[model samples]
Target chain A: MPPLKSAATPVASVLAADARHTVTVVLNGTPRTGQAHPRLLLSDFLRHELGAHGTRVGCEHGVCGACTVRIDGVAQRACLTLAVQADGRRIDTVEGLSQSNQGPTEGRMTALQEAFRRHHALQCGFCTAGILMSLSDYLGRNPKPTEEELRDMLSGHLCRCTGYAGIVRAVMDVTGQAAACDTRSGEAAHV
Target chain B: MKPASFDYLRPATVADALAALAAGGDDARVIAGGQSLMPMLNMRLVQPRLLIDLSRLEELRTLKADSGWLSVGAAVTQAELLSRPTLRDEVPLLAAALPWVGHFQTRNRGTVCGSVAHADPSAEMPLCLVATGGAVVLRNAKRRRTVAAADFFVGPLTTVKAADEIVESVRFPLAAAGSGHAFREVSMRHGDFAITACAATVDGTQASLAVGGVADRPTLRSWPLVGGALLSDLDAALNAFAWDLGGDDDQHATARYRRDLVRRIGRTVLEEALSCRR
Candidate 1:
């Protein structure tokens, strides 16, 4: 039998005594890797370490959906996750959604953005990023959710100012006119 | 608040993880998704010297069905379980109970094994597993053993899992065709922790009930089927168990209030389960 390896590595010693660790993650269509502490929260790493501030943090306890991001193509809360946990994984923040200058190109946010603008979905703007990420993820799985399904899906998110009426309208408008949106480029973006 | 510093190790195998835990001694902790553990760490409730990451172990991420049982790996995330088509048909109770575990975001990283290992009395996974008579497989460097759900939980936030052992998987027996399972909980908010949770499963003449959150460990009661008259007996049994188990008072609800709620919820869940058979 092979000799048994030592399993007694102390996490405190590693974390407290400054043992450097590196993690690789694909963020926003680009492969990015960095060195970080094991205790580093993914939300903090994105906003402070990597300067990707589009992923906002609200009610870090996982109640509010303001810290939502896509991890491995599924919407996840960044604030509640450790950066090291996302190592070797694919992550997409709100910044990956669309480009202002891209002009409805592939994977662009033309229709959803237009719907939000048309329905006045956002107010205060603090909760927009998280809502957008969640909505985008939902629409990808269910392109045409009924009003009840949309309401249930949006239950995880909070929009204190808009009261969800505008957001629901925006989702319905975008989904109801999905064919027209599909004719344009970037409407087929999943995850 | 910043989490207290801790060493991180991503072990490629379960043996390595167990060795790391043994070596780190009491200061070493196993972390899967860090969804629950991270919050506890941030709150300064636990400060382990080492964090053994189990994410690298591919063996712990599988969901397999055998002849009589379906086994779910410890590191299998809630999102994975929710999406797995097998679980929907094999264990409908788990499927129904999972969405209430947290939210889509938390579920993305939270693992079923991690939740069960944490042994939060009010947690959905533990209650559902116990109700279904699930078995937990714990492995160490030298040996591995399986503990039944009835014997796994010893107290709140505590289990039979040894410090040097890692939870490998949980096995749930497949329900018979006429079987039915139901889970319900009452919480202050939609996504908050449950003040009281109940799960019941009925298969023909046999019935099993497991109640969590209102007790230190999941309280389970099983008996042969009887008609409406037996409900009062079950309610009495629950009321007596509630007082006997010391589930009456906590930050969420008073001891007296909890006892009342448990009796009410237990009867309701049992009645619901019985109705499905007829």
Candidate 2:
């Protein structure tokens, strides 16, 4: 790969305005230090500063779960957390499940990902990472979740696609529980 | 949207936090879970000059079950309280209300006292605090005082907290033996803020009723426990009910509908609590 040619020259004042806080964090097992504005959001810091673009942000007011990430092994809303608040802490974003390992499947695609694939749980792929991260933290504590309980767990996420059928099935299949229904919605069923 | 530039101060002690607040004057805000405050900051609704993070104040992180009450420190997260069996036992109203605070993730970082201090009129913790007759412990450099939850909130998102004072903890008195607690709320979505909610604790012939989202702050009423109140003319009671919190039309619900819902949930929770006592 070669660097793309660009005619735009970089400006310095914008960079100067952002040099307010020196935040150090352990992100996905790596120690990184950078300068950010005191109010830079954790989601923006991950995407812009560390280039972890997999951590998506949809609703910034903390309603949608698209900006979910793990901090100290706890799933949290990146949009609701400030970068300086994350200083001296550990964070895990969707980049942790990126294709980093040599395998037939997506690199670092944990069991939940495989289950999602098996059930055709995702379509637009926008909320996939956040949902996976949210459930990864949730399922660790609730391995034998019931269908009603799993639906309650999934309520935290807002999916405009799939109608949540496959997502529920994937969770049930992974947990060896029975699905409550067989109907799929909107997107063509791939499974 | 991101927050505006501000200094972040992680104070080592409550005293230091108070000093920072005093020095920073009216432009300083405290951050605990940052769940509520961070959202406000992101919306650019609030821009403080300094943020006093109370995450490291060990003295404010205590959760002790005393003889007749439970005191939760300012730094204790909502999830922490939900995880404690004793809180679920002694202050059962809090346990019933904690899950409704927000999603599991928000609860993981949102502080119990912070929620009370943030003072959302429709929030579950404030309703519980008021319904159960809880108290918010306030402290400044000069003195410390405890204010009842009923007297704490001046209006929506407003409280009696001064510039130099910090909400150290919230104390919830234990429910009487054989008392039954019930919580009910109607929201568009499962984890969203309530349209109207009710909390009640009934013991024998006594009952405490508190309703939120129908008023500016949680509207509370205490009276003798009436048998078969759920089966009685709930509509009549709600029709004549005064929403002291000042109900008004909003995007989520109409003022008339909110008042109607208050009566419905109020009757349901009060009846359920009474039945449980039996």
The top-ranked prediction according to lDDT is 2
Note the DockQ of each predicted structure.
Answer: 0.32, 0.28
- In model 2 chain A, which range of ten residues has the least summed lDDT? A3-12
- The TM-score values for the models, in the order shown, are 0.87, 0.89
**Candidate 1 chain B lDDT trough over 10 residues, lowest sum:** B226-235
lDDT of 1 by residue, A1-191 (tens): 11112222223223432654665677876777677787887888888777889988787766688888987778888877778767667778888888533645855676777687667778787888988888778888889998877876677777798888767777877888432333233243353
Provide the TM-score of chain B versus the true chain B for each model in turn.
0.93, 0.94
Off by over 4 Å in 1: A1-20, A100-110, A146-152, A177-191, B227-245
Candidate 2 residue-wise lDDT, B142-164, digit = tens: 78999999899888899999988
Task: After superposing candidate 2 on the true structure, give the runs of residues whose Cα lies further than 4 Å from its correct spot.
Answer: A1-18, A98-108, A179-191, B226-238, B242-246
Docking class of 1: acceptable
Q: Per-residue lDDT for B115-146 in model 1, tens only?
A: 98999989999898889988999998789999
Native interface contact recovery, model 1: 0.45
